[model samples]
Target: MKKEYMAFLCIVAFLCIAALLLTGCARTPEADIVTRKNTEALTDKAAGGTENRKSLAENRKQTPEHYSWKYNNDAETLQISADADILLPECEAVPMYRLSSGGFTQEQVTGLYDYLFQGRETYRVEEGGLTKSECEKQIVRLRKQLEELEQQEQGDGQGDDDWFPDDEREYLQGILDERLAMYGDLPEVSQDKKIAVDSTLMEQTGIDEREDGRTYEETTHSLECQTDEGDSLYVESGSVDTSEFSLLSYQRPGRYTYSSGIAVPVDPGNADEKKSENLPCTYQDARALADGAVQAAGITAEITQVELLEGLAENGEDGVSSERSGMYSAFQFQYTRTFEGISVATTASEYVNEEEFSLMWPYEKLRIVVSEVGIQEMEWEAPVSVVETVEKDVPVLSFADAAAVFEELTPLSYEGKIEKLSQGETDASMDIHVDAVRLELMRVKNDGSKREGLYVPAWVFYGTESSTVYTSDSGSAEETWSETEPTPWIVLAVNAVDGTVIDQVEGY
Candidate 1:
């Protein structure tokens, strides 16, 4: 049960992230991706107190009435609903392009440094050494935790520290002891504070043979710096295979958990009565801040998702005690690459050899976390540089044909997994319902030795899956149990040009 509960929680978080990626929309001039809004029909229906006359028309525009797939046998059932539009491009054909990563120039590195450290006291940090200020902050945080633990042990049963397990007391003490020792031996800050460019950071790490017989290039270039305000910044450009991506993180030592952890928005429906109790900045404000940060980093992409970082409340369950206060902390935005005004389809799953794929080709994404105070963190990973166009106006399949391909391959993607998961149940069934189908660019690797790939048109499917089970005990009627999870996954990616299914993880 414990393992199942933990798995369920992970599944929920995965679905939440996937849903945000597919449905999130923050249009920029560079990425004019379609955003359909049927507000007029909704308003008309509300005014008339019934379904509006144009409801049918709007539904037609959103999804086709037919093309659903269903299958049933003794063990389970698979039902796929093609309830979303096959949003194809306006042009007759979509072009494919070759992509690769390259090294960063000295000018580029200098410019990035200037932009990141402008108007701030920044000092280049040597590798493997802790700063005096950050060290002191850690010591303070550890001491405070020890103090809280001690007080909790001596307090009445109603104290908030019940969530702090008694067994971890010794562990915290060990960490505090180490920090105290380190603090006494740390060096003070010097007057020479100007950052010097580490030329090695700009060089490309050529192919390296690993112990597992796999070869890779260390494409990431990184630098660590300390600010006068006790904040530390660690920036990395490029990734394991290339140097075009960027990552900037601001770490405030000993930050309160409630101030810097994963969070979701408060219920907007209750915002009126709970205005003062939730996030201070509105969505618009957060969006503007996020745009500015993206522009500062010189990134050209589309905002795929924006989420409010409203802290979690301490309800007796879920390990959070009521003593832990909740408040609005930050805003997180996810961005994806765009090609010729079309956003590339993105996914978390990698369907190939993990080590090889990561070292050669990985999905690119940009994420920014902003707070009322300022931008907390920014990351752009697995960036690609377009080398050339493989084909201009490449003819592609029609939506009808693509739908045919979607129906054919989706089952194969989930074939054995469903049966394996429901093996022990007496009476078990499953439903695979697809809610959205998108026409987007998919990166497929060029069959060669070098790190190169082509971005081709593919039809990506997204939706949910659910399962039910009925079990009986001795002399008792059967009890029903069920689990439903969003499958906003790239269930299958059908090549628009050839109707062949593209492996999302392998990039081919």
Candidate 2:
């Protein structure tokens, strides 16, 4: 009895341990199923948490490895086949959604596609590249699908009638019309040719010329006969009936016409001779020729210097014994010509008689002199000791005659300025400061009045202040003063007769 009881207890302990082990294995599988469901739910949430979520196993089975994300370096190209299911990051969705390659941006591709597929029945893809055409074809197919979807949506009362704006639809319709017009069938060529030239020629040439000639009974013929072994003879003849030789039936032979003249040879030697005769010659030809011929030559010319005498001897107001000295006076000039050449030097004076001074050459150096009283009174004159002489070529004419020729070549008008003017107050001291007024020559007019134009030389004192401040009854007066300290003055050139200011020089 005791032994049976011990075996039963051991059996009960083994059953208990087996039951606990079974319960533990069942709980582990339930926990594993719950954890797997939670993980799947988390993965779906990561993939946008939509009903269209595809697991990794499903994605691997549906899409090929080549259709997955790939990076390319060579050719700088990125290609995505139709089978591709690329999923970009949310941040890159906008920029990375389009494909680009071969200098064609995504915008251009989209524009081309939009032009191809989004319009009316008039629109059709005439011809295009493989990729663009394929894209257009896909868009057309998608549009058909969209139409079916729209039908279903309308049936379900979910149709979106605002899919395309009015402006966009009109633009697309216009584009379709333009494309259809551009690709319309070509027109057929007309077969008239005024109608047919060949047919007309055949109709004109249908009659035989020989038959036509035979109708007139005037067909000319030639025949020849010869013996078996003897010399042969030949004869030729032609005949025409008077009825067949109508004036309207005769035709004139064509003649060729050409230009009426032939090209003549040019005589270059004659042309050169003509050109040489027409060439211009210089005025100094005689002088150039004589320069080589003459062995020696001398020249003599004279220049006059006029000055205001400051102090000179003069008769007093009493006109007799009440004499005075150092008074202003005038003087006379004496000229002498000197002959200097390879031969000798001879002096001659204008005051001498022609017969006495005949030995002296016509062209000789001349000296001038003035009275001592005049020299002392002249403002510009110093003590008269000696004068510098200038040599010039002597023409075959006299000095006065040459001067006349020069005057004919040069203008003979003088221009002066009314430099200073002083208002004369009654009994007011009239000790006016005299300034050196400059003068210049200007163009002459029809009227006898002179026109004075002035230009002051660079770096010269124009005038004193007292000379510039004077008021006078001139027509128009202008004064220019320098801006620097101790300003220089410039008085404009004015007409003395009419008092018109002709030209002015601005002070620097």
Candidate 3:
């Protein structure tokens, strides 16, 4: 009797416990979902399952064929029309890479030389600036000019301020006397002597030891050759720093003018005639050649932008228009680095504080100008060596979300321009037309160091902006002036992970 009673109590206790669990489980749908999710997660972990992770990885690999979206503001101040293929990493997660200063190896430098110069013989040129005879002729011409000016001053008895001023007369006389005296002392012009370029001779030209125990060295080599068409080609290749941040440049001084901000062929004498003719090569052909050259150098880059080098008709202060210029002298191409099949966007404007401008860090770039003669100019600066992957995969926000951020910040981005337009006009309106949106890697500086940076995914908008201003003379025919910029202008860049607006000039 005692055993049976104990068994009955035990059964009752078990039933009561079961009933309590059932009552607790009778929760709202939200609570039930949470419980179920927690159970499934635990079950998954116990079963050694990673289905969720695998699914995310798989999703990242799936790329869409194209991307399209349209948005317009209520006031029509901003409009976006996007119908472009997704030219970015299709993966849901992207790996960030650490970059350090790097440059080319000897083999790579030789490969570059072979690709550019090939079988052509190279020469060492000492530029003969203004031959001795040229100097004598200049001195004679200046003396004649001074004599004429003196005669004019004596005959006219006027200051001639409208033409040459009194200061100019003295300056011309000084220049003439100096040149006449220095003619006999002028050094003989050096001749262009034939020479051999030893690609292996990469001599260390400079070394800098920093306080941080970092030693940076600059090694350089140069080769000069005359083209088959009698044009001169000067090639300078070098590396700066430990891993060798490399540079390879090509120049044709006679054919093109080069500056830090521009690379254009010297204006042809028959520019007006060439204006109607086609370029030396089709853009397709030039692109192909450019691609081949890049490949030869063993560079991983994507061509981001291309522009035609055309001449402009300058309007002089005298209100006369100069001769209209040519169709295209060269095709300019810009390339950015790529990692894991994704390329970096060239939209970021380099940021350097006024105090640090002199010691600013160099960024990576590859710009080439292809002309009729061939690749007239190329600049590849500050190549990087990937140290390690920061993350195997980092989840990023959707394009829609990123575009929303762009919309929110568009006004702020052009706020200054809009305010300026509003001034001096009774009415002013700005219309920003965004045409292309690309997901590309952006170089964000690492914490506390300008020398290091991490490449993260970003959405960059490309389009044009037009602003129209009107003047009202009491409604007597409102004067309307409108300005339209060229297309493919970098509108803005947004961080895909955190939706932060990135200022290209500031480089956040």
Candidate 4:
């Protein structure tokens, strides 16, 4: 009887276990449905009219549906929403800030050092160490001489500081003599020329899969443009691009054209895509190379200044050349312009500042790539025809008064740009500041509607804006402040004679 009773209890226990298993939650699909519905409702309640919706509204306010850049104020995050149809899964974020460059920096230093010390192919060394770039060397020598003079009491014949006692003598004895051969008398001031381009058929560079092993690489680009009055222009250059073409300043109906280019590999062998070995060329070498190329293309506009502008280099990695820099340290020699033989500005001697020149001359220029293969790729643009007209000379306002006038004219808000270099400190802020102001006396041309453009005297102001450094781990970013040119923030022209503003492509 005891054994039977125990067996009966065991059977009851097994039946209960079977019943629970049959009615378990795993067998009920409705439970999952219920949980999913509850989760969906909870998620909607949390996000709707809350974090996500509110943020989207704010982002739309800052950036419209038409624009790409969006900012989330609360999170302090910014994003650039690309085209809805396009996809760039490999693309990385780009930093919001890059240091602004303006005053004498790396370009000037490197160019000057190389030009003075290193010799070039066609740049012959004279008996007295004089080369084609003698003017530059002379300026260096003059600066040293000036320093020696500053240490002494008088500009007497007893010491080596007897060259110039005054500005006129200094100009005649040192500067004039050294510059006579290169630029006879007063150097030609650049005349204004304008070209209008409506970029059609722009094929943006997508993610490219270039060969990783590149001892040398070459690229090509086709120039396409049409004038504002309806004229078609097309040309091609050797390299893909050094800089994406942008209309820096435009005066309508100007003549602009370019020449075809050639490129050679630095090394035909090595089968290596290692590093962007510095192109074995000094500043003097660069100058000579640029000169030969420009001359070969029949470009006569003189090179007033040479700058080593940092440009995009091909990485032996997976990225487009248009947007990112790679292992190779790429550079371009940008030659700023002045109308070589015909540049004229009738102004007081004190106001003639040559160092701060380009802000005024919105004219001709040249850009060529410097590589181990030699200087083959070049971009040249200048005036086809300029009809000069004489205008009655009028007296102009002082520099102080001119600055005041410019301030009154421009409606600038120091919003996001860095403050101008400290009037006192070394660090610069992210906000825009106007620290330095300079004036250039220019002979602006009237090249728009009429046949004769005015040979009018104009006062051009150049202001330097401060820069903020970006060290984020974004697209091709570094840990330190980048060595960039000082920012030339303002370019405004005030009529020297009548106090009227010349309305060209205004502002920096």
Candidate 5:
């Protein structure tokens, strides 16, 4: 019995210890359980809170067609509606607080109207509401107002830098004043009389046309007319009295008729006379005749000044040959005339020793002076050929041959220093000088296959102390040579397929 009792006690103690250990492992802390339960409750409340509440009014408002909602104060409910054809009832104007229900507020309605109807021509006001003249006047007024506002914005203390300079502003004002003065006035200037001289008629007056129908060669007289204003006009009205002037024909030393049908007369006696005569005009006889004709025509003209211009020799003193030889002469005569308080100057030039002996006189300049009452004088240097020579050794090249050679040799990439020392042509050959040349070749492959080649020609120039290289590629490669050296370098050719180099030459 004692043994049984001891064993039983040991078992009981072991069972008790086991129970305590299990209880200790299975039980959670009170504080942790409270924390977990509280958290779960808060999450539940949050999930079911105000955010989950949906009203019919709000739902209707979310639809685009309905797109409207209103709060009813009397009914304490929100109402909403939507449909494609539905129209909201228009609200009467009311205080902000009173508009707590129905339709939109004034501001909201205005915004809606603006959003829907802005920039659309469907809503037009009225036609002919403003006349064009009234509109223009309003525009001018608005512009003036805008200008004033701008001036005010710039401030009074600002300088006149914003406006035109004084001289320009004054000029503009004067122009405006002149324009205003012309508003109701006749044109201030008269149209100019442009008389086109008939060259055929004028040619009939020349000594060469004496055999023509007109008997200008048989009479020698002058006519004068007096204008109503007491102005006198003189005209050469008489014929050339050829019967009194007998032909004293004498052969001249230098006289010759050219194949061009021009007759040039040179008499030894006349040559001595010409030598004795002052450089340009042999006598004042021509001027006297002109004056007499003017007096006969009743045109008031006074000779104010006369000048003699020298002639240029057909060949230079050394007689060097040139292309310009015998083309023109340098001798001329200038005369100034005053008429109707206007001073006009004119020049008459004679081309002598040329195949064609030509004479040119200025009549337009004289007319302009007479009309404008202003002194107008013009002087020009006549071009004369002093030398006559043919260049014997000048080189010439055909365009096609030059282009072909340029295309062929330009592709060869030569390696060396290049200096353009000289370029010249001889009668037979053209000469080109280059100091150095360089060329490089590059092989390129595409898609793991060698399809194209690249050529680069580079040149170093001694004159410019620079170097340049040109690249040429396959398919699209072209060869070009240029006299002007490239800086750094330029791509001369590009390959269309496989992008391979064809030719490249560099120059320095």
Candidate 6:
């Protein structure tokens, strides 16, 4: 009886414990809703992770770690793949001649003389007292008109015989003559020495024919001259086309047509003779040639440094290229206009493989293409010196601050097919490498006029902005996959300066 009672109590305790467990296991409606919400949140997270697989590198601003930000140190350079397929049509480069005794043609002399003189004409306008003189003349004419009107009224009744009124007519005519005598004539400036030298040049003019059928008539002309005040000015130019060959083709946007690839705006004529002999001369020789041209033209600019374009790089190159078997045919010289040994800022000067210029092309320049023989040709801007120049303060932006400007995202666009890089990147959007930073002096003209410019200091930077183009497309905005590299189009001179951009082509 005692054992049965103990078993019943144990059974009751077990049943109560089981009942408590069942109560704990049971779920309310709120609990079930919370579980469902947690599961949906996890599903949303997974969907977001699946949506964003590929990311764009350009979305973030990039700064170069490899380049020195100082000009005195190593500068960064970029390899720019040129769309050589495009060429400038109807564009002719000025031919450079060996500074000979022969002088400029009559037309050349007259044109330059008039050009500079015309520039000074405005200067004399204010000084000549012409405005006051005109006012006095206008008053005198008014008096004469009134006198004539009174005489006509008096003669209205009289016949033709009395119409003259000789005494009144004579008095009025005398007054008019006196007024005319008071008016001073406009001023004229003469540089007799320059004109005398020009006459000598004209006497020595001649024409020569190249081995090719082309004939380049070279006549010495003063590209620059000086006045009594010692200001350097371009007062003369020659009627000469000293190039050894004629242009066979031209390249531009959309299409490029050339007679021969060799004529690729490189050395136009054949250079068979120099191929055997040590082809390339020294940089010293190149510098001498440039100085000679400047001296011949009477320009005041002195080239401080003459750097050779690298065969493979932009900043600097490994020793000199092989003279005979190099990619270039001649020594190209770039002259950045200077004043008193200080460098002047030029906008459209790209002196690389060859000197070229164009309003249509983004970065055009005036360059001299020289060979072993001498200066082959020149392409330059018609730059004129200011009669008066003003100085401005240096830019407020610091070097590092200017560098930080690149950290901001900017849009880059390109035309035509691009080069294919081993690393797959669409060069359509460009990434620039900050190579060299410089705080240098530069000049900008006022009111878009080539004359009366201002000299100011700016932080100039040089670098390569790279880009890639696509031959085809794949994937949507959210998801993308590409196994093959896309075509790339890139142009450097992501220039490359500071201060106000006065013109389209801004370079240091």
User: Using lDDT as the measure, which candidate wins?
Assistant: 3
Model 5 ranges off by over 4 Å: 1-283, 290-298, 313-333, 340-363, 366-508
In the range 1-508, model 5's lDDT, one tens digit per residue, is 3454344345434543554465656432211111111212322332221321222233224323312221222322111111112111121210000000111122322332222223222211123243444444455544555556566557862465665444444554565455444444433344333232110111123343332334333332222222222222222222212222111011111111111111122232342243323223233443443343333323344442232222222355334333232321111122233322322222221211111221111121111111011111112111111121121111111112222222222222121122121123101111122221111111111111111111111111111112232334455664333333311122222111111122221100
Ranking by TM-score: 3, 1, 6, 4, 5, 2
Output the better candidate (3/6) by lDDT: 3
Candidate 3 global CA lDDT score: 0.57
Q: Could you tell me the lDDT of residue 431 within candidate 4? A: 25
Task: State which candidate, 1 or 4, has the greater TM-score.
Answer: 1
Candidate 4, 1-508: lDDT as tens digits: 3454344345434543454466654332111111101212322232223211122123223322221211122322211111211111111210111111111122322342233223221111123333345455566666666666555435454454544446634754566466545544332433333443232222333342333432233233333443333323343222112122112111112111111111112221221233244545554555576665544434344442233332343333333334323233322444432232222221111121122211222333346654454543444332223222221122233333333444433322221122233223333333222332322324333322111133333444433323344444435544435322232223345543334455442211
Winner of 3 and 4 under TM-score: 3
Model 3 CA lDDT for position 101: 45
On residues 16-79, what C-alpha lDDT tens digit does candidate 1 reach at each position?
3454477577323111111221223322222221211112223235445344556454534555
For candidate 6, lDDT tens digit of each residue in 1-508?
3454344335434543454466667533211111111212322232221211111121112222233322211212212221121111111211111111112344434443343233442111113344544546565675867576676867663556655566665777677666566555432332122332221222225675655555555544333333343222332332213322111111111111111112222121333332323336555565576566555444545332222221221222323323323344445455555444444433323332122321112221234544544444444444433332222211132223333332211111111112223125332323344334333344332222112223343334433444433333346333223322111111221111221222223311
Q: Which digits, one per residue and each the tens of the lDDT, describe model 2 over residues 1-508?
A: 3453344335434543455475655332111111101212222233242222232233324332222122222322111112222221112111100000111122322332222222212211223323433344444654555556556655754445665434454655565454444433422332221211110001011221332344223332222222222211121222112111111000111111111011111222332222212112221331222221111112221221111112222345322322322222222121221122111111111122133211111212222112221111101100011111111111111112212221221111100111112234111111111122222111111111111111111101122222123333356564432221111122122221111222211100
Query: Candidate 6: lDDT over CA atoms?
Result: 0.33
Instruction: Provide the lowest-lDDT 10-residue window in model 2.
Output: 376-385
RMSD for each model, in Å, please? Answer: 14.7, 63.1, 15.7, 30.7, 50.9, 30.3
**In model 1, where do residues sit more than 4 Å from their true spots?**
1-74, 90-93, 102-118, 127-209, 213-220, 230-233, 238-278, 312-329, 350-352, 355-360, 420-431, 448-450, 465-488
For candidate 6, the TM-score is 0.35
Model 3 C-alpha lDDT per residue in residues 403-503, reported as the tens digit of each score = 55555456544654555556654666777766567777766554343345666667788776678887887648878989765433567776554445555
**TM-score of each predicted structure versus truth:** 0.61, 0.11, 0.63, 0.32, 0.14, 0.35
The whole-model lDDT of each prediction reads: 0.55, 0.22, 0.57, 0.32, 0.24, 0.33
Better of 4 and 5 by TM-score: 4
Q: Tell me which residue pairs clash in candidate 3.
A: 60-91, 60-92, 102-244, 102-245, 103-244
